[model samples]
Target: MNFNEVISNARDSLTVKRVYGDPYEKDGLTVIPAASVRGGAGGGSGHDEKGQEGGGGGFGVNARPAGAYVIKDGDVSWRPALDVNRLIAATGLAVIVYLISRPRMARARAKSSESPSES
Candidate 1:
């Protein structure tokens, strides 16, 4: 192509458009029309805006109850049911064992205390 044709083509592809706004304003704070608002998660903190240390609201979508169902390994599952009877039995056995050992432990402690210290 001729030099003039090449220059003209480059100029045609390089048209400039003006953006009307305060360049320093936060993103969503600009007074654009409602219809012009593009849908998506936008209009909060600007790219350069320094957000608060930790002042966001609302629990996240993943927040749930302690025993809530969760998916694992492509399968749905929930916390196991508690066995009240087994828990009670285990607790009772622990108490019995402690009571039975208390006297023996006390006797051993007394014997140790009565023993003379070696030089």
Candidate 2:
């Protein structure tokens, strides 16, 4: 296959149908699972003085569950998927922010608690 062909194939895989799975009806409700999809492709070509030519390409795709659309009784609701990794990262960030601000917060509290000196 050629470089262009490989890239095209990679792009083709990232379709709406792939991102959102087929809707299935259960208990009079339609559930459509949604996902986040990403893809990348890279290619390179080289020609040597010995009249040798070489070309190579690679493509990769990744998909992660993002959420789902629940349709029931003519009403639609979105249910988000939970990512443990993201939650952990967020928690770590919060802790770091708190630790960095603790000193400033303590200083403010101390200043407020100090008795006003008689003018």
Candidate 3:
């Protein structure tokens, strides 16, 4: 298949219906869960000096719960979903950043403290 066709297929698979999911009813209330979808696709073909052909392609898709649409008694409301896994990952990244920067920040502080000042 061509690159465009592959990209189109990826998009088709991540349609609104696939992301938001089907609505279901429970206790006279309808809930439609929603999700955030992300995807990328790329392909390339090249020829070498020896007249050899090379081709490569890559694609990725990620879907995560965003929220849900709740309808009850003719009223509608939105309820958001939280991903603890993402939260933990973010926290870990923050700690790593702080650890990497702490020494630099300390050195800057020390340098400022040692600088001469006029009374």
Candidate 4:
């Protein structure tokens, strides 16, 4: 397809409707699901020395759950998406940092308490 088609398709996929789903409502509660969107398009054209020409273009779109808006009793609030895997990784990293530092701290304490040799 041509670059124009690629760009047009990209625009359709990157619209707000794609990022924000239809609001769900029940019992006076409305939840609007939202997402993070990213897109890109690129094209290039070149001609060979033998008078042959070629061109190529492509587009990409990415969307992920960002969060949601909640409305109830005439009050609105936001609930953020939680990535459990990321949380676990961060916690593991912090624990590793603490464990790695504890040994050095103990050694430093021991060295400081030692009496220095004469001269």
Candidate 5:
């Protein structure tokens, strides 16, 4: 499967819950799988009206609401989003490329080393 599919599958396997944001306020929090954060699958945009027109050849009022998602505390406590497995895979690929190119680099070094030095 592709990267997206892998992330989607991981998201599907997680648990979620809905809880109150603050005991005093009526706002609610929907706690989603932590994996959802990595996949961009949890939050979405909201509507606003302040962004409409441009003034005198200037840029228009570009306003957009930020997406929100709830993260709970645990071994899965929310941190900055990243895919650890993907990072490892990328590092491995880089190592492989470096290994594959090593022979050419070595050949060039040998050629340079073997050249007679100018007196």
Candidate 6:
């Protein structure tokens, strides 16, 4: 397909529908699944010394579950998606932060003990 067709196809496919799915109703609850979608398109055209023209384009997309909207009893609530990878990364970062600050905290504690006691 040509660049215009590719772009048009991409635009149609990459939209709110991709992010939000049809509402599911069961057990008196309505759940609308949502996702995070990101995409980009690039194209370029150039001419060689032989004056031949060539053009190319491509689209890339990344999607992940972001959250869902839950509706029940005329009330709505947002339920955020739990990404295991992100959770693990955050836990690792917290551990690293605590480990790095452990030394400083110990030094401060030592200095406070050395200083005269407050009245």
Candidate achieving the largest lDDT: 2
**How many clashes in each candidate?**
0, 0, 0, 0, 0, 0
Model 3, 13-105: lDDT tens digits are 777886788999999999999999988888887899999987767678888899999999999999999899999999999999999999999
RMSD after CA superposition, every candidate: 25.7, 2.8, 4.6, 2.5, 15.9, 3.3
Model 4 lDDT at residue 44: 80
The residue-by-residue lDDT of candidate 2 on 1-119, one tens digit each, is 77998889997998998799999998999999999998899898999999999999989899999999999999999999999999999999999999999999999998888888932
Off by over 4 Å in 2: 104-119
Candidate 5 C-alpha lDDT tens digits along 1-119: 34455446545543242221222212443443322322223322334588654322111122222223454332223334455777899999999999999999999998888858742
Q: What tens-digit string does per-residue lDDT give for candidate 1 at 21-117?
A: 2222243332311111111111122233565432222111121112323344445554443557778999999999999999999999988878486
Q: Choose 3 or 5, whichever is better by lDDT.
A: 3
Local distance difference test, candidate 6: 0.92
- Point out the worst 10-residue segment of candidate 6 by lDDT: 110-119
Deviating ranges (above 4 Å) for candidate 6: 104-119
> If ranked by TM-score, best first, what sequence of candidates would result?
4, 6, 2, 3, 1, 5
Give the alpha carbon lDDT tens digit for every residue of 1-119 in model 4: 87788888888888889888899999999999999899999988889999998888999888778899999999999998987888899999999999999999999998888878832
Local distance difference test, per candidate? 0.43, 0.93, 0.88, 0.90, 0.46, 0.92
**Is candidate 1 or 6 superior in TM-score?**
6
Assess every candidate by TM-score.
0.34, 0.77, 0.67, 0.81, 0.34, 0.80
- If both were scored by lDDT, which would come out higher, candidate 1 or candidate 3? 3
Lowest summed-lDDT stretch of 10 residues in model 1? 33-42
Candidate 5 structure lDDT: 0.46
Per-residue lDDT, model 6, residue 16, is 88
Would you list the clashing residue pairs of candidate 6? none
